[model samples]
Target: MSELRFVVQLHRARRLHYDFRLEVGGVLVSWAVPKGPTLDPKVRRAAFKVGDHPMEYVAFEGVIPAGTYGGGDVIVWDTGAWVPYKDPDPGAALDAGELHVELFGEKLRGRFVMVRTRRDEWLLLKKRDEHAVAGWEPGEHPLSVLSGRSSDEVKADPEWEWRSELPAERAALRLKAEDERTRKAEDERTRKAEDERTRKAEDERTRKAEHANDTEHANKTDHTNKTEHANKTGHTNEAEHTNKAERSNARARKSADKHATTRERMGEGARASVHERGGADAGAPGPEREHTRADERERAAESAIGGLESLRNEAGLDAIGENGTWEVYGRRLRVTNLGKVLFPGRGDEEAVTKRELLRYTARIAPTVVPYLAGRALNLHRFPNGSHAPGFWQKALPAHAPQWLTRWREPGSGTEYLVADEPAALVWAANYGGLEWHPWTSTVDHPDRPSYALVDLDPGDGTAWEDLLVLARLHRTAFEHLGVEAGAKVTGQRGIQIWVPISRGPGFAETRAWVEGLSRSIGAVVPDLVSWAWEKAERGGRARLDFTQNAVNKTLVAPYSPRPAPGAPVSAPITWDELDDPALRPDAFTIRTIGERLSTHGDLFSPVLHTQQSLPPLT
Candidate 1:
């Protein structure tokens, strides 16, 4: 072999990991070792096979812009040549699910054995050799062999350019953003240092005043003693003693006043220093500082939604008129009845108007748009207040904008709106759309769905607590099937779970599979679940509605605000929250969803990316 090269890059990205690669077939066949390699022969490391990279990447070390693959810092930790120990060509052996190799890298020098455990999964074992150490850890030596720089150093330098995975323009924009963030942090540090300097100068001035006072007191004592020696020595002694006592008292008072002043200044400085932190009182003392930070965090959470809550003074803006043209995503939209209230005020939540609804939809577009994209949508419109009346709009209106994605049903020839972007969502919301329901399937393949559905609908007489138990059962069933699923509050009286899959099965097959899974789960706890089509027959149990997998059938899209009381939103929840006694389907409303999104970003985002398959039913 012509000097087969290998490289192990210590990647401190979104998470710390290592990219282990070997040059083969003019490309770098790579594997991701999360904890990095160890020399202990007894230790077998897990390696997940990833896509091949170009040979040019062997010397690559730099910062990857956020949102890109392995977006963070990278450093060439170790690199050298490798030779097949047992097989003539390592490539053939790698394909055969086992490979024996002798590494001659800067840090790693040993005979290693690699064996495949599953597709894209492998075990790398260090062969017992002279090079093997008992407790070899990766981070003990973090400097890159190529640049002698750590991953942290690489991330801090703008010159450590990002690779071309992102478009040049977008990448440049991201680089600019990074520069801005760095500049802001630097500015904050400078301000903090300046505050410290100011406080120190004040203290120095106070100290100087105290020194001056002490000098004056000493001079007075010296003059009094000289006068006593000159005349009336014995008579002046008692008077001199009284004067001395007065001088001592004056000095003590001055010192006390100066110290108190200094303490007050320091407290003020501490407050000033943390003013911009938004979630801390850095100047506080001991446990007070800790408690202040916690309080500030709670306040910060509230402040995050300040804009949402300040529904006051919303009327006076030409930015949005009762009826005016608004441009969104390069499309001009004419919105009417901007001040018309669609949802009445409930308790602490302010009444939601068409304008406010449009704003909320636009604000949340980035998080919600992915779920709506590529799918035909059904809008539930409430022109009047939600308490008054509402109706579902299935077919797209003829007057709908031409730019909007339109899909024609195969049989009825009725067209549906495919809201695949922010503008479309805002436009729909402006038209009295309260609840948005996107089909489980997309426009391209209406039959093959990428998500299997499970809607836990609480029937008559079912307590909210019972649904919680039933939801837990669903988690158990999903785990047993070895599929990843995401849960969400339906904003009404149900919980919706969506399992992202590698689409191959048609809607019929997917529906059947979900139904089977639901049936099995129901069988486990018959009292808590209902499979009965009739509402009264179920005796108030939560129904696992798997029928939503069919074509044209839809559930309220996540983050979609329901027209029910409190303007509740269909919000995403973590799987672990199912067992939480405090979990409530109605807790997340339009007023609070923003803060949740800010604190815990897109909890259900994995549903858009996780492509795990449910093992075939025997």
Candidate 2:
């Protein structure tokens, strides 16, 4: 008899059952077998005749939803070809009441016989054969022979609709990746094009400069020839002609030099332009572009005139006892009496010099400039030494460099120093800037402060612990209104808490909000905190000086060095640190603050970024 394709599907419906299918007449002649197949010669399993199913059902393995026909998990248990035991026509024998077959499968291999015991009911028995054993069972191997999936895995398979979207999702991700590559390539191409344009422009400038130099040389040569001819032709007396020719030659030399200088300047301009565009300066002249002695001195008198390396070198070049000019980041500033102690000796310590102050400002500029930039400076000038009395100058001194940006007050006509960049800070240090106090508002919005400050000015009896408690109370009030507040040690004897707010509200509105917040805090700690504006009414409690949020009022900015003996900074602290009992006002000083900053960058940066509104006052 011809061997036919056979499949055994282990199906799990309300009860577990095995579907035995044999390919016959272009369809699968199916039967449902409970207790599964057995290879034991003595064992017999009950089988119920089922209707014909599609031949393709041999490979199907998945979950069928509940309430559907034969709804349950189904998996292909075993599949292989089978041959009739002895009869040539097994289909005719199957119709005749008894059918016998030799089975070959991953899990079932033996001589099996099916005999009709009743209407639509048959007994499948394993015959005594070489492949049959006394205790062999198919139920011991429950996984699908095709997919290795068990009944539970088949049951948990997701719906086909959801699984079908994976290919499309993968395609979209591939397209997005390709688009990003294309965009990056386009950007590189555009950058190259711009670079090429800049190079061409620089080449043009070089050519023009060279042409101008050549013209000047030619004109000078012609003038010299004319003067020599006049001397030889007897057109004028020899002595007088010689003197005139000398003067003419001098004029020609001056004119040629002027042209050469102009050409050099043109090349410099081209180089600067290229640098600004971040393009290659291949055509730029090298060390030959060094400024003349006059230009050098002029620039030195103006600002520190160099890059980082140059600044570092110039910083050490000056003698301590002399007045000299040095370049710092391409600007020049004059420093006098580098050896003179700006701050006198205290206890076992010696003193801090003017140069030390400049170096400190230069060293801290990268971090300090951002805090001071765009904010008007109230300089605490200590022209003598730190021990001597220093005066506060709201207006920048007349000697301030022209490069320094200044903000003019509305009615007072006071021009305040604006440390717009690192160089400006260096200039301030040259002007004996011992302490930096920046206005609450920036130059962008002088009347509208970016944050409201609650300066905790402690009375004689007010403890540091009480100030910490008050700071927490302020934070609580701010959080209740959905605002984020930061705390900082004042570097002096007190503390300040700051809440970032939207810039749309003027200082008046912010001050009012601060006042409300202060009142709420005062009510919470009535004995320890005071909201009264007057210092006398604080009853030895810490004053919540909300007036510091007014338009022109300022608190010591974060990271700003105080003029104290140890150069303590007004350092920003996390709320957790603020709550620590060991947190001291003088914990972070200039000497140690730099290391902390390198580890934790700009902790108070949120003050310049986050925006929040105050809740309506009750």
Best by lDDT: 1
Q: State each candidate's clash count.
A: 0, 12
lDDT of 1 by residue, 1-618 (tens): 334678899887778889999878878899999989877788989999999876656656667778877777777788665667688888789889998886756678668988999999999899876567777788887877644556777688634455566543223222345555676567556556444543455445546656776898979958867776856545576678768755634533343335224322112222333233331312224566545544543443443343322221122222444765554555656567889888888787678777777777766765677789988887888777688756566656535666888886542233678887778988788777788988788888876788888889899878888788788787766545445677898888889898777777766567668888888878887888776543655667777877566555678888999987778899887665665566678888787788575554555655665444555754
Q: List, residue by residue over 246-283, the lDDT tens digit for candidate 2.
A: 56345333433452243211124323433454433123
Clashing pairs in 1: none
Clashes of 1: 0
Worst 10 residues of 1 by lDDT: 309-318
> What is the alpha-carbon lDDT for the whole of candidate 2?
0.64
